[model samples]
Target: MHALREVGVEVPEHTLTAVTGPSGSGKSTFLQCAAGLDRPTAGVVRLGGRVISGMKERGLSRLRRTHIGFVFQSFNLLPALTVQQNVLLPLRLDGRPRDPARARELLARVGLEGREGARPGRLSGGQQQRVAIARALITEPDVVFADEPTGSLDQETGAGIMDLLREAVDRQGATVVLVTHDPSVTARADRVLRLAHGRLVQDSWAGTGTVAAGGVPRDAAAVAGGGPVR
Candidate 1:
């Protein structure tokens, strides 16, 4: 069975693009394919102008370690590692020099400065998610693919996670592709694309207008009904 079909979307550099749809609409499949976590049956997956779909698993692994970061609904932090260690895992995986200062700085940026010594088991869901965010950015990846990043958080915590993602684009120039189901979360994206039954259905710029078939902007609001883009 095909999880997705005839899907083609381009995300501009340094932008936060949100993918939204109802459950089982292939949202997560799209993210996994785009991020090179899973191979697509057809069509190419490109990152930084390079085609990744044809690359071998070893090559793809290297590409992800150096250029891509991921955040998931489960947080995915290692329970055995302290917050600081968890944040530094990416750097260590890439065989790069460990920079404790950088890890501490990221922790501080994520509002977890004093909790670095704490393990994931001892932290609240929000704090653990913050640590995950820090870990994702620790490598300063060219792109971050977040899958339901806020799905497990409370409303306020979820909002905070969104703010951090925006900061990554604005402050670090990292392109973010977020998969979410919440309209409120979609409101935060610079561009919003909706999928239905594995096909692209809506494409629009937040607070601007609907995007036409060829990616041209029409006069409609960012979302369909002129809802606040936040």
Candidate 2:
């Protein structure tokens, strides 16, 4: 993308990296590449040691379905579909069967326990985002990518969403990588990686125990024996 190159954003190699900076700092560009939605100008994009950048569009789609989960800022749910349907869509797209119980569990974890039958338009902004979060985690993808996941909600709702994400990170063992201009969201992040013109400029890895495998931040190497990121 013109914006991506203009800002000099590059794909990250850290297991857990945070892309942060000013409005034009290239955080979105970094997320697009990390999520395999955008390709880098001159670097390989990998997930779980697989070279996804070289894959064909269909292959890349498959890779994303199987390995990546993305949460958007807008709560991109289909108005025509019910909450359960929207959450199950990604798994269905990959030809994976849906599990109502599992889907319900995820929604409940995000604090949307009894609203699975409601339409996106019928819910509050926070509730819609909760559906989005539930959808994002439905597949149990190896890596979860959230681009400004809490940009539009009130603090209370945002905190609920973050707790759900942290729950996934701890209970599901699924690696989470998100982007935002908000510091509150990053407080729970295992590491923080700042970006300026698209390059990694700062890394704050909490420690090996801060997060699990494949969750390293840029500029911070794996702790020996995987003890911590800090």
Candidate 3:
């Protein structure tokens, strides 16, 4: 993770990044801007070779619906819907046909095989998180942005969720941007990015051919110290 400073900080693409910071340090600002959920005061956000900030709402909406996936700390499931129904929300929202079979397959993939009919309120915290993951992946997005995704779970449950996210990235070639203040979550990332006082404080790259903080290397590992140059 490296912040490109033409005007303000911007994270470059194609690697796993764990974002951390104190409150109001711009972790959420960075991610929302990066994902086009919010526009920044300055800088650019590029993902999968497309610049995110300048796109029109229709285009961005299309991009988000078809190419991007987001997982929030709150599972954000429909309480009245079954596990399968909740997972299918995205597909349904897009005016697409319901595919019950595909829904069950995804639930099974996330270890929620037989719990498909249970409503969100009836599931455990970890189970709900799994449903959120399944919802994120339903569109087969290029990059999955998870914002404090495990904030409410216990250590073991959080680890399980991280395992699922990692497997999705490693096995499916999906890029991941995980935002959290937790070191444990950061440790699982192939690369880690730290932010402080509204700027990127560190870009830890941990993998073969990983580069220094300033260079955004694919398969990076974590490093501690001064932040990536901004």
Candidate 4:
């Protein structure tokens, strides 16, 4: 699927950036390409100044395991593994020694401390999402790509997930690239970009009054009034 075209944008380090657009506007496609989960048909994808679009499958897999973290809407945890095991899976896959202490700390940070022994199927939607967040951070990845991480939750639960993501950036100095259509979610970002018809229509930094081509001012009133920029 040719989901995006002529899209160009740089995600600043240690910041939360949200990409907003209508359904099928290539928001997920953009995230997939940026995270090296999908290669672009044309043009290169760079992560931490390295080109990844042309990498071999084995090399790309290694790169993702080391540098990229992902949180999906579906809370993609292994159904049978305990929460602790799921969080440590990434590190194990990368041939790194498991650190039970670190795993416990992460689970605690996400408010899942006592639930470590529980499987995903036993957790609530919010708790499952929290486990996914901890798993994404297990390796201290250079960037975290969250694709509608709150899409399946209620408003209150979604807000909680957003808080955890913001904390990840503030406390862990983690870079986040988020894709969503929720205005409230976009408002939480340090920067916001809008995609329309597979093209970036706007890029603006929060509180900077700086707007890029086809971008809007990063103001709450503007976002609320404008709705989805598609």
Where does model 2 exceed 4 Å of error? 1-16, 207-219, 222-230
On residues 116-230, what C-alpha lDDT tens digit does candidate 1 reach at each position?
Answer: 8999999988788788888988899999998887876778767877887898899989999999888779888989888877767778887777665345564432212111110
Stretches of candidate 4 above 4 Å error?
154-157, 210-230
| lDDT digits (tens) for residues 38-90 of candidate 3 | 76445556666678778889888888888789987777888999898888888
Largest TM-score belongs to which candidate? Answer: 1
Better of 2 and 4 by TM-score: 4
Per-residue error at 15 for model 1, in Å? 0.9
Lowest-scoring 10 consecutive residues by lDDT in candidate 1? 221-230
lDDT of 2 by residue, 94-180 (tens): 998888898998888777888989999999887887788889989988788888888777888788888877777787777888888
Q: Relative to the unseen true structure, what is the C-alpha lDDT of residue 82 in candidate 4, on a scale of 0 to 100? A: 96
lDDT of each: 0.82, 0.72, 0.73, 0.82
lDDT computed for candidate 3:
0.73
- For candidate 1, the per-residue lDDT at 131 reads 86
lDDT value for model 2:
0.72
Q: For model 4, how does the per-residue alpha-carbon lDDT over 60-97 read when each residue is reduced to its tens digit?
A: 99998988899977878999899999999999999999
Q: Ten residues in a row with the worst lDDT in model 4?
A: 221-230
- Residue 215, model 3: lDDT of 57
